[model samples]
Target: MKKQIMLAVSLALAGLSAPAFADGSGFIRVEAGRADVDIRADGIGNGSDDDTAFGVRGGYWFNPNIAVEGFYSRYYSASYNDGFDTYDVKLHGVGVGLVAKKNFGGNHTGFFVGGRAGVARGVATVEFDGSLEDAEASSAKPYFGVSAGYDFSETFGLSVNYDRLKSGGDGVDVTAETLTLGAELRF
Candidate 1:
């Protein structure tokens, strides 16, 4: 379903008659950055750990501030180490968002902001001694975030954003907050 939505969006973009080569028009963007997770538990007490995450976001601007976007992320090495045992945890998700800007000048620099909503999922396992215990999580969640940046040219720039992830599945429910410093590629 996600793939289909992306494919359809891509096809639509491909079909869009390229807008005049104006300063504030249509363009596509790609981003990568550092991430972290905040795990929330109800019955799964204080026996867990977390590691850093990495993600990518892509957006297409219809104007300076508003565009359609999609994002995917993965958290690494998140787990818990018991006195003599260890548990493993992992998280993955994808979402769609909106991009809007405050500038309409046809320049190469500006500030922007927007919002997003989509589904997210996670998985976990317990590593006891030499054996493995299975646990999994999946959910259809809504996520949102904010961003600010400075464009270097018509095709290069930098930005930063922070987001809170709310998702639950199986017997596990978690929330995470992350700050990212990333590069943007515009086309």
Candidate 2:
């Protein structure tokens, strides 16, 4: 399933890399929103909830239609109890991606879609009736999403997008889906 999804995204990006007006924009962005997280484990009930999340992203557009971006996001902590022991989990991730976008309706308003392949780290701290146990897992993953925005001026704009992180290992599986609204400054 993961491979298929990655292949599909790659194909889509290759097909969409057509040249645009080519402006070479560079920017920094900060976003805040919510993340819905799901943690599944064997012999334990799933821990799934919504929590506050935020991210910072920076990118440099090589043209009006293409850019490379890097981002770091922090998600809210989730707690789980299954009649015996309780667990608390907090997840943070960083990644780099290629963003293919096009400017339309002038030079600053349009829609973009991109694919991301990166690594994520998961930290799980478990509590067993007065004792504490901690485990960490890291994995490389892939995700794809879309966004649309308009530049209020030549240097500022707002955008919203949905991003998902798929990660699993070391006795736990987690999927984080986040919707974020952000402000950006272009220079």
Candidate 3:
């Protein structure tokens, strides 16, 4: 599944590299941030933790105000310690979404605000510190985010974003919220 998503993103990026699409409509972004994860299990106490997170995204602007994007993200392992045992959780996902933005001056360079919505293939893994066995769960979930940024030039920009994502199955439920800083390069 992961491989398939990667291939799709790769193909989309290749398509973006074509000369016909090079009118500053294509972009790639790298993001780093912190993720807060909340976990709830059938019998165990609820747990919450924060960790480092990172992601990469590729997108194409259909116009000055709208675009489609594909992303891959990883939230580093987060650990929760109860009185007698410790649990570590890891999460990663791939998603495609739409972005709608308003540029301050009706151009690509300047302040911008945007909103995004999409669905992601979320995968969650939990490992126990003691004798309990490890478990993994995967599901598709809807995600949404808002972003604000300054475009220093038509080719470069910086942005801050907040996103919410979910993953769960069996007896465990996980919610992840991320605050990220992104650097973008447009071509």
Candidate 4:
């Protein structure tokens, strides 16, 4: 009974989405940015760290104004410096994101909003820089994100996004904000 209800709801949302963005153009984009992770507990290295990330993104249209997009994102190398210990982290993620947009007038520009769902993997390596004990942990977590974008031409656009990945592990919760520039093609 409950399972049937849940399936019905999923189908309804999916159906609602395609119609709102029934027509769309396809595109491919690449982005680069920085991220930080905040540790909310006492650990070997529990603080904010700076890291670099890059990714490839693409979208396909169902009609002239709606489409689906996915991104493969990876963090190069992230490390933190604490008085008691030094820590290292490696993070990788992939997601399928969908958005809908359309032009209100003959301005040749448009607006869009979409959601993304995906998985993330993290590898944390800790070393005692002072008197703290060393440790290591690996975790696989699920995440979701939302985004909005505008088209500058049939081939180019820009967008901003935010994501939350709450997989209960490693004594901390991790999340980040992402900004993107994109390009698209029309059939």
Best by lDDT: 3
- Local accuracy of candidate 1 as per-residue lDDT tens digits, 74-153: 75455567777667666767776565555433574665554555444444333454565566666656677777777767
lDDT tens readout by residue for model 3, 1-187:
6577657757865776456454538889999999998888888879888889999999887767778898999975777899888998789888988889887954578899999997787889879998669989887788999999999887788999999989889888888899999998987
What would the TM-scores of all predictions be?
0.71, 0.73, 0.80, 0.57
Score candidate 3 by lDDT. Answer: 0.85
Q: Which candidate, 3 or 4, has the higher TM-score?
A: 3
Question: Which regions in candidate 1 have their CA more than 4 angstroms from the true location?
Answer: 1-36, 46-50, 104-108, 119-129
What ranking of all candidate models by TM-score puts the best one first? 3, 2, 1, 4
Error of 3 at 53 (Å): 1.2
Clashes of 3: 0
Give lDDT per model, in order.
0.61, 0.69, 0.85, 0.56
**Could you say which candidate leads in TM-score?**
3
Q: What ranges in model 4 sit over 4 Å off? A: 1-25, 40-45, 79-87, 105-108, 111-142, 167-172, 183-187
Weakest 10 consecutive residues, lDDT, candidate 3?
15-24
Model 1: lDDT equals 0.61
Put down candidate 2 lDDT per residue, 34-112, tens digits, no spaces. Answer: 9998888867868788999898988776665667677888876667787877776678777667776555646555443
* RMSD of each predicted structure: 4.2, 6.3, 3.7, 6.6
Per-residue alpha-carbon lDDT of candidate 4 for residues 8-45, written as tens digits (9 for 90 to 100): 54585477665555455567767776655555444755
Clashing pairs in 2: 22-64
Residue pairs clashing in model 1 are 23-106, 38-176, 65-99, 65-100, 65-101
Residue 89 CA error for candidate 4 (Å)? 2.0
